[model samples]
Target chain A: MLTYEPDETVAHALDPRAKLAFQVAFAVAAISRPALAPLGVLSLLALGVLLSANLSPPRVLFGYRYPFGILCLSVLIAAVTIGPPWIDLADGVRTAHAAYGVGLVLLVSAAYVRSTPVRHSRAAIQSLVPGTPGRLLGIGVSLVFRFVPVLRRDIGTIRDAMAARLGTERSATERAVVLSSRGLTRAFVRADRLSVALQARCFAWNPTLPPLSFARADGLVLLLSVVLVTVPLW
Target chain B: MSTDHEYDSVALVPESIVRPFARAALLAALTGAVAFVSIPIPFSPAPLTLQVLFVFLAGLYLGPVWGSVSLLLYLTAGGAGAPIFAGGHAGIGHLFGKTGGFLWSYPIAAFVIGALVHGRTGFGFGSIDPTADETPSGGFFDSLEVRDPATVGLGRLVVALSVGTLIVYAIGAGYAMWLLSLSPVEAVAQFVAPFVIGEVLKMAATIALVRDGRYELS
Candidate 1:
């Protein structure tokens, strides 16, 4: 069963759209900077948001690790593969600085966004994207969110069946082949069904949409984003 | 040759056929549970999980409409802050970002697989509730009744599986291309190729199980 839930905190209260804009802006600004300073600032901001949300250290740390692993690996790959190599004792420093900076920004941005509520996030995205495509995108996002677990369960059932029928003694190669081919087929069939349902729901666009109400807090948050973003520019 | 005779005379009610929505949903929920078990890939951001196995089975077990609907429900729960995702990671942001394409393709992929399998006449008839007897001591292929060769043949099975596999790979590879910013060739090199062998084996097992009536929902 699904167990993630939004914490009742002020930081978690921002509209997902606003948070997304700010997070993207923060990440972009940090990325554009010459070095790691801006990224450090962004990380601090993420920490601040996490603290404000009153999320526990364990939960936040857990969230950080997987993405951090991806970020580190990517950075390592880039450092080895990308050019602009001017080496010395300080070479590691420069490479690490660039990699960590980009990695941290992306990770923090994802973390902040993930903590936000889905419906609100969708509404926010809908507001930002504009027109029919935007609405469709929202629906797409919604449907995907629902699909992951369902697919997970089916996989388990099939896996057990394979174990039973093919015997657990099947070679690794054989097991993998069976899993992937059958799994892919299932995914396609499920998609077809979902598409039909979505079509029936009359997912569409409204040109004259209702305006979003901006509270005093939204303004304050926007101002804060401006300040954070401008500091790098300054 | 008249085309009318080719079609089966079974009374088909679309609504009645579509009623397995809940079963599909249940299967999808189980899919999320499967994501918890991951095998590390030394060089990539993604880990190999037991997840895909269930995804295919969902299609086979639930058929197109219900299978996909089940996945949708799982995704909805996850996005709404349900911890039913890879490593129990869940939320709206996961739905919006880079890996979103792959995540979004789940239902589509499942439905395609399900529809393909459902098209095979032998695959469709195994709905006797296996859960009615929950003893794990039952032998492999216990509940299955091999279809009459004259009435339904394995040729259709091959055709259905081929089509279903194509759909799954199309979605997965397409998503990988977009997410990685690679050309089709490059994307397959990085994503699809590495996984192809494994996929093939999994499909065979899945096909066998479904053919043997292991997937018929209660």
Candidate 2:
């Protein structure tokens, strides 16, 4: 669900730091506004940003369906109450506002993650927060992003293998247990070897990580982030 | 081909700094990856998530410091927009939203679980040999036997898991109540009650894994 693309677009071109700043800006703007007006503005802005990033709207919206469904369900759940006052329709409206805020926030993050390479993101974190723990955390995060897709694929393979073995006849509990045991064991093995390999290379607390270079566009993106953040606070 | 050692994921290597960090990193990544394994129930807002299985295992395997450290890394990475959270959601915004309590309590729950499973002294890299702690003529304190982690053993693993689950529920339900502006009873009813069965199943899975993988769950 969270796949990255290798491309050269405006969204890809922006510094990861600026994109991170934009995410905070978008969150504030979306959360601070109570009315639907902000969502409309947000939707239009998200569209423009997506276009700049050269990402397809239909695919993005497709990815959103599941979360959108969950949001709708939450709105329904939040609306329910017993006895006097019956149902709180206003709560549903408020939840919807929050959902829109979350959606916009997600969109900004999606753009940044989809476009930026794991190495670039790592470099951004290392540069932003220098030192040993910061370097480890940044490298660790990059490692996770790199491995997520592989693990997701493993789940798919396990599900198919189970299905082939007539797993459909088994109870949900059985399936959960089998899948978890398999997945966790595999993860454990991979982690073990990875650590050995890292050790073989002589892991250093301050090993050289990728470098981050701020460009002219980064300045523009930073300025835009400042404007985006300031408008909501003001 | 080699026999995959159980608990190799958390075994303390001698004189190595980065091995533990790498292992913790992978475990943290595993936690994030599996968090999306959600099972829907007809009546509950909280779908059954596999997060606890990983979280509990981290503590039971790595002990408190590294286990807690790994979970915090997961949270930090997820907060930094890594899509390493449940439902593929990322960013700092979820820190205060609907799932706030459950999400916020993860590192602490992991810590508590580790503390219970691996006693405080056991948290050291390797098991402290009782004899090593004991001096030639007399012990550091001759009266007290050199009881180290080997004494803790696996008998109480289930109990530790149960306590950790409660910790998560207590904090989660409390936060959910506040966020929803509901009474304590209502919060328990709404947020905590529905997921009890799922949690039991998860605990059972962890127990089976621990028993099979290695005797030392800590």
Worst 10 residues of 1 chain A by lDDT: A202-211
Tens digits of lDDT, candidate 2, A1-234: 555678878888777887777767766676565356656877788778777777777777677666557555566666766776878888766656665666666566667657777677777777777555566678788777767667767766887899899985775556666777677667767777788777676554445555566899888877877776665655
Q: lDDT per residue, candidate 1, B149-216, as tens digits?
A: 12234675556556655665677657534433334664455446666655565556555555554333
Give the alpha carbon lDDT tens digit for every residue of B1-218 in model 2: 12343323322222233545666777777777776777654455566678888888777766677778788778767766567777777655555455657888888888888888777443443322222332223322122221223344566877888999998999987875554444565566656777887888788767766665443222
Among all windows of ten consecutive residues in candidate 2 chain B, which has the lowest summed lDDT? Answer: B139-148
**lDDT for B36 (candidate 1):** 68
Q: What tens digits encode model 1's per-residue C-alpha lDDT throughout A24-107?
A: 565555544344555666667767665666655456556657644643443343334233563232433443454454454544
Q: Model 2, which residues run further than 4 Å from truth? A: A33-43, A149-178, A227-234, B1-15, B35-48, B76-84, B87-101, B122-159, B166-194, B212-218
Residue B121 miss distance in model 1 (angstroms): 12
- Residue A18 local lDDT, model 1: 61
Q: Specify the CAPRI tier of model 2.
A: incorrect
